[model samples]
Target: MSYSIVVDHVSFGWPDGTTVLDGLDAAFPAGRTGLIGVNGSGKSTLLKIIARELVPGSGSVSVSGEVGYLPQNVPLGAGRTVSDLLEISATRAALHAIEGGDAAEEHFAAVGDDWDVEERARAELDRLGLDHVGLDRTVGTLSGGESIMVALAAQLLKRPEVLLLDEPTNNLDLDARERLHAAVGAWQGVLVVVSHDRALLELVDQIAELRDGAVRMYGGNLARYEEQVAGEQEAAARLVRTAEGEVRRQARELVETRIKIDRNARTGRKAAENNRVPKIIAGARKRQAQVTAGRQRALAVEKLEEARERLNEAEQAVRDDAEIRIQLPGTEVPAGRTVLTLPLARAAGDDEQVAGVGGKVLETLVVRGPERIALLGPNGSGKTTLLKRIVRQGAQVPVRYLPQRLDLLDDRLSVLDNVRAVAPSASVNDVRARLARFLFRGDRANQAAGTLSGGERFRATLAALLSAEPPPQLLLLDEPTNNLDLASVRQLSQALSAYRGALIVVSHDLPFLETIGITRRLRQDRDGGLAES
Candidate 1:
């Protein structure tokens, strides 16, 4: 029960009255902890409060030592250099000036005792797979993945007792992700990471789940947590069934008891009217019967209420994640039908230049029926460029492409409107009904696409793409799981499972690709030729 960070009676809300964490109390111990939750479950907000990036509305947080936080989105200054990001620019400058024969007191003060600051900076960068990123290089020159890695290096270089990382693996490619996983594994101080990366979570000593505005700790890693949850859910389900049966039985008994009591009263009244007994005696007997019947009815009602209460309690234990259930028969392509033909390589007699092909041209890539193809490549290997070319060239059937940025959505338009735009022929009611299957119901379906969380936006975008006007038989997704949480990843897999169409997905998430049952795996060679891996 020793702790590194403590949050007491914490409460936070936005100006728009969106309550995130309410009276939430949690403690993080000195070990690697994986923080996970569904989208918008306040995981990021809690991390920010712990990091002092945002102030909590009430309550307090205490940390045992210095804290370093790497936010989900690392703010990049266009003019800042890697040295500046690592926070050693001042010290490095002072050392350089002193070495060049400047006796300013400020230089001596800035250099302090950290004469090896430059070497330490380089070591930290190299540890995080950023050795190639020079200290003097501008941050703008790095890719998104490299920028995040550099930010992490900056935190590591600080040597803080506590480190908080929010979605640290979000933008990292496969190699960068591996390096990050290694860093997490090697950390000796208190480390808490909020991420959707399953591989990263596997390295954590414990899993802290943020759900329903509370944090629950589970000993061990993500796999252990899932096993526990699955078992708990099964037990909850059984209790619910038993509770439901009891409620139904009690309801039936209550009705029957009332009927029997009424029948007895009627019989007594008839006997009294027939003068079977003296008026005084009959009146007393009737009063006694009335009291007994009243007690009986009250008892029945109490039992019924107790049953309902038990049922409610049982239901609360179950986590109800609504599944997306939809049959898109229109999207089904016949086994013999051609879905698409993209010239992944150059054509003979065609002068079109293919980047990175190195003169090794591939034949026209043909997709038929409902084949699931995984498009794999390193960053900047022209995977996205090839996808764009395919989209521009068009498909043999109705096609839809969901790009990495999710820019397909009209920011101002509601989710309902966005989906309806794609399915112009479908009625509003029809579109909304389909959206409900994607977990957008009622006012949720009316939310502006721009205001949605990363997971919500992904769901909305998928809904729109799947529910297009002509019912796309050829679906293309680029890095679909880039920012999705684990639950959202499962949701995406479930949604794609129901999709009976040809799919070409560009992704580095091998586990996710497995879930979708990819029929073929195609790798983009360094020379730009697409080959089966």
Candidate 2:
């Protein structure tokens, strides 16, 4: 099959000597591919290498044609305009100069037959639902979602033969996410994206999984890839069971052989002492028997070791994603309890100042019981602000909020210390035990919170939140799945499953919301009204 991108025996490491990819090789055909792995698996680093934003320590990367890359975190430089981001400012300037009758050779040279750069840029922006964003507007003036869409639009306008995107759907609202997914689905060139956005991944032609320092390709989209992995895991599990039985049998036989040899030795010794045969002959027989027993024991021990080795190999075949297994505070807000009450309309009073939910009959936002609510809204719709207001005024129960930026943890503190800070009543051992459930075991728990990878930080932040002293009876999460890898998303969902509190999570990840068992869906409309969908 023809390939548009080829990575050959690539290896890379950070300046701190932390190894990322090692002798990695991968090839992408002229179709979209979903690149997925746990956080810290080098997904972003690999994309950077392919984009030539970072040089690999060894090997090389070759692309079929011009490459366009949209990094996960778009650098929103202050005072940089959208035209600058699109890289069409010069052409636009030249076009305007020519329109003004400045017959400069440099202007003509800069135009380079791209006189319609402005129109094309606008069209691309409109395609990505960025029509609301002006080309001359500074990036800093745009919302996070708007900036992402603009960055994506910049890459799309290049129309390069190869495109690389890292977490392109991050911070996007539902509308923006749909638009991005549509754009990705229509991509014709070699497109590869590193993202936990399941909807975007579902549009890919293949799934490339990065794990254990290697890349493995599967011949289908996210759902199909999951099916294939599930089948493989099932078969691997069967092999493990079979290998375990063989190891047990080998161990039992080894024990029996040793017992029999000991019995024989005792019998021979007793015979020699009783002088059943000449002592010299008995001694020779005993010596010969001892040699035979030694040889037998060695053979048995070898077989047992071989069986154990096979068992280990079989177990290795099973993928253990380091799933987080944690129990949230068992504090359940009663079903009839009024966890939070907010007048969403602008009319009520001081407490309801942060009001307005689209057109739904939600004149007042009243959250009761341990209801898991999915907060859906467009960019600039005030979802995050609403979450903050809830913390400030609404929630009657003990509450905690995890912001979208995940800046809750104290960077200087160790993970254990961070958790301890929130749950001071709990013993250090208790916090350590809880952190272990989040996969921060032993020394990992002692690492400074600032040193954690995206996934680790999320887990650590979550551990601290749930381990709060009084235990949150109402939890608010803003874009909780942002920057998380697929497995990390799963781990987050697992952690939330044990949370016995009312939750209001703002996110565009529909599949994630479904996994967390959201009981209700609330959308904040651009008109500042809250509606229940």
Candidate 3:
């Protein structure tokens, strides 16, 4: 297969002297490629380097044609119009001037050969399910998911030969995700997307994983990549077992060799002491035995060292995706306990929901016991607002709210301090130990929360909530898996499994909700309407 983009010995790092990528080399074929890695693996950094959004510390990236990139966070401003966000405002203005009988040369120059820029822009936006977003509308009016789709449409309008998307599905609801997936499926150029969305990854032609400072490519989609990795891990596990046995055997043989050597020495000493044979013969035999013993001991030690090296290499092949171990039994709610109750208003019309805007519910709903609830709706359908309201109204039990933006953390505080702030009665060592279960161990617990990557910040925020006083019997999580990588999502699921409290999670990640054992699924309409699904 031919390559569309080639990264040669690329390296990048932050100003803190923290290295993200080192001597990394990767290539993308002329098709959709999904980039996968744990948080802090530099997937976004690599994409930026390729897009020239950020200069690499060393090496270079070679692309076949123009590159268009959609960053993870789409910058939104209230004054910025949709036309400006699409980046065709100038062209549109020039086209308008030309149409109004002003055939100025500069207007023609600005318009270039794209007199149909408006139509093309509209077409792209429509393709991405953003036809309702008027070009003159301010970005502040759009929902987060709408803004993302609009930004993607902006990239597609350029029609670049190479396209890079960083977590494009983030903040998007299920429908928007399908629309984005359809656009990706229809792409005809070299496209690289960094995402953990299984549905988005399923559309990729290949999977490129960044781990341990290197890039490894697997043919086909995420499922194929996972299958291949699973097989490799299974083989590695067998190798590890075999290596362990070999190491044990070699260790035993080494010990046995010493015992034999000592026994021979004793035998030789008796011969020398008793003069069982001629002194000369005895000396010669003893010397020969000593020589043989020395050789045996050298071989035994060498074998043991070799076995250990093999074991180490075999173990390296296995993945060590750390899981968050939430073991707070205090968070457990009684089976019949009422968690929270929210009143909802009546629904307006059954009109299709806008991308983000939604009405508020003013009626009533009750959450009881250790129930797991999945809150699903269009973006801005008051899901997050309702979560905040629940926290504001106060639950029957101690409640903790994890917002979509993860703004609960004090950026200036270290992870340890953040957790301790919530649990003042807990000792520093106890907080540190708990943070370690959240994958912030040792010195890592001392790092400032402001400097953490998206995944790390989520973990830190979660650690604080779980570690809070009274253990937070009612947990409200809004888009909890937004910035999390696939492994981290799995880890989150594992952690939630240990929570015996009530959970109301606002998310579009159906698979994740299923994994967490959601007991009830509720959908909120554009109005304050809440219906059980």
**Which candidate number would show the highest TM-score if scored against the true structure?**
2
Residue 297 deviation, candidate 1, in Å? 0.3
lDDT tens per residue, model 1, 183-220? 99999999999987888898999999988888999999
lDDT by residue for model 2 (401-498), tens:
99888898999999998998888889878888988998889999999998998888999998888888788999999998988888888988998888
The ten-residue window of minimal lDDT in model 3 covers 353-362
| Candidate 1 lDDT for residue 491 | 91
Model 1 clash pairs? 356-527
Model 2 pairs in collision: 344-356, 356-528, 357-528, 357-529, 357-530, 358-529, 358-530
Candidates in descending TM-score order: 2, 3, 1
- Alpha-carbon lDDT of model 1: 0.88
**C-alpha lDDT of candidate 2 relative to the true structure:** 0.88
Shift of residue 347 alpha carbon in model 2, Å:
7.8
| Per-model tally of clashing residue pairs | 1, 7, 13
Error of 3 at 80 (Å): 2.2
User: Per-residue lDDT of 1-533 in model 3, one digit per residue for the tens?
Assistant: 78999999998988989999999999889899999998999999999899998999899999999999999987778799999999989988888888899999999999889988888888988888888889999999999899999999988889899999999988898889999989999999989999989988999999999999898999999999999999999999999999999999999999999999999899779868886688788879888998999999999999999999999999998888777876879998889888887775554553434234343333577999999989888887788888878877897899998887889999999999888899999998899889989999889999999999878888888889888998899998989998799987988888898888999999887778889999987888665577666
lDDT of 2 at 197: 89
